[model samples]
Target: MSIEVGSKLQGKVTGITNFGAFVELQGGSTGLVHISEVADNYVKDINEHLTVGEEVTVKVINVGKDGKIGLSIKKAKDNPNPKSGRHKSNPKNNRNGGGDRTESFEAKMNRFLKDSEDRLASLKKQTESKRGGRGAKKG
Candidate 1:
């Protein structure tokens, strides 16, 4: 069977790499599901989600002129509110499968200010230590 763009097919995960996973689709065609297309959250590691020999349903995102195929497992239909324009929430963002409001702007601003001050102080100390607790001595 010829694989076309936007087609959904079941495939076996033949290989898993840091960048993406290789899936063997129907008709012996192999496609890559990029790390970013594996999920909506930060996929620092792809192994955490899939492994070799796993069967997955993937949508064909692209069919290159050179016969390369691109697959995606994180399409809209796979998650809730696919048309909401919001990314599928990561587990850390939800509690018990329920929506949870994140920190407000004021709270975020306060935290940013505190963190910035700490970083600035640390830099100043580093500079002072290198200069014997004063400005850099002139040559």
Candidate 2:
């Protein structure tokens, strides 16, 4: 079976790396599922998500000119439950239901600046407190 782009097939996990998992599809072809395609969330470790000899349903995302096959376990699963994975309106929540729409660039910068300022002020106060205590040691 010739693997083509957008083809869905069952494959066996042949290797696992920090970045992705190697799958052996039918017809003795192999493909790589990037870390981002391993799951709907942040895949810190591909081994934790997939193991050798495990069966997975993957979609052929791309077939490079050099014959490198790109597969995605996430893309194959994304459309089945589009609304189910939608994240709720909670900024602090890290749950991976699906895609996340974060603040705009300007808004993010503003938030970052605010947090940074708070941290810097706290650090300066701590340093001053330590410096003030150092003088008491000698006196």
Candidate 3:
């Protein structure tokens, strides 16, 4: 059977790399399932999710003119509860658009400056104490 875009196919993973997994499709065709396509969430290591000779269902995402096939295992699975993979933004949280505000910019800046000065003073005191102790060390 010919591999077509958007078609789901059963295949066996032939090889795996840091980037993606190579799956052998029907008629001895091979395709790449990128690490990003392996799961809905972040995938740090492709090896943890796939291995050589593992059977997987992959959706054909693209067919390049160079005969390269891009596959996605996550897309092949039917998601009953569909939701965006990333966090959705709330209109109420928009600062530039003038939504809600408890403090003005100048007030916030003053508060930040005060906190920074406090932290810097504490750090300077700790270092000075350590330095004084070192200078007073006997030979």
Candidate 4:
């Protein structure tokens, strides 16, 4: 079978590592399903999701010129679980309005100026104190 990007195929998990799982595709070719592509949720451990010799459906996500194949098990599923750790609530409806509000150019410039002035003043104060309050030290 010709393996092309976006093609879905069944493969046997030949090896498992911390980074990813290696699978032998239908045509005796091997592909790697990255740990992040193992599941829709965060996969801290690949072993928890795949085992050696197990069969799994994987979508060909990439095929490098070097003959390395990149697969995604999550994308092969009919209905992948929604991404975890993402709140379902809309941020725009939140009190901060989802941080969509933009600062006007003038406002941003003013804030920057104020911050720069404050930093400069603090630096000047530190330098003055270090030099014995600005006046030359008495011998």
lDDT of each: 0.84, 0.83, 0.88, 0.88
lDDT string, candidate 3, 10-71, tens digits? 99999999999999998999999999999987899888888899999999999999999999
For every model shown, the clashing-pair count is: 0, 0, 0, 0
Per-residue lDDT of 68 in model 1: 93
Off by over 4 Å in 4: 80-139
Clashes of 3: 0
lDDT of 1 by residue, 1-139 (tens): 8887888899999999889999998899899999988876668899999999999999999999999999998872456445443554477855335642576889767877998999999999988897788655677
Question: Candidate 2: misplaced stretches above 4 Å?
Answer: 83-139
lDDT of 1 at 12: 97
Please list the residue runs of candidate 1 whose C-alpha ends up more than 4 Å from where it truly belongs after superposition: 80-139
**True lDDT of residue 92, candidate 1:** 82
Between candidates 1 and 4, the TM-score winner: 4
What's the distance in Å from true for residue 9, model 3? 0.1
lDDT of 4 by residue, 26-69 (tens): 97999999998998778898998899999999999999999999
The residue pairs in collision within model 1 are none
Give TM-scores for every candidate, taking all chains together and pairing residue i with residue i.
0.59, 0.61, 0.64, 0.65
TM-score of 2: 0.61
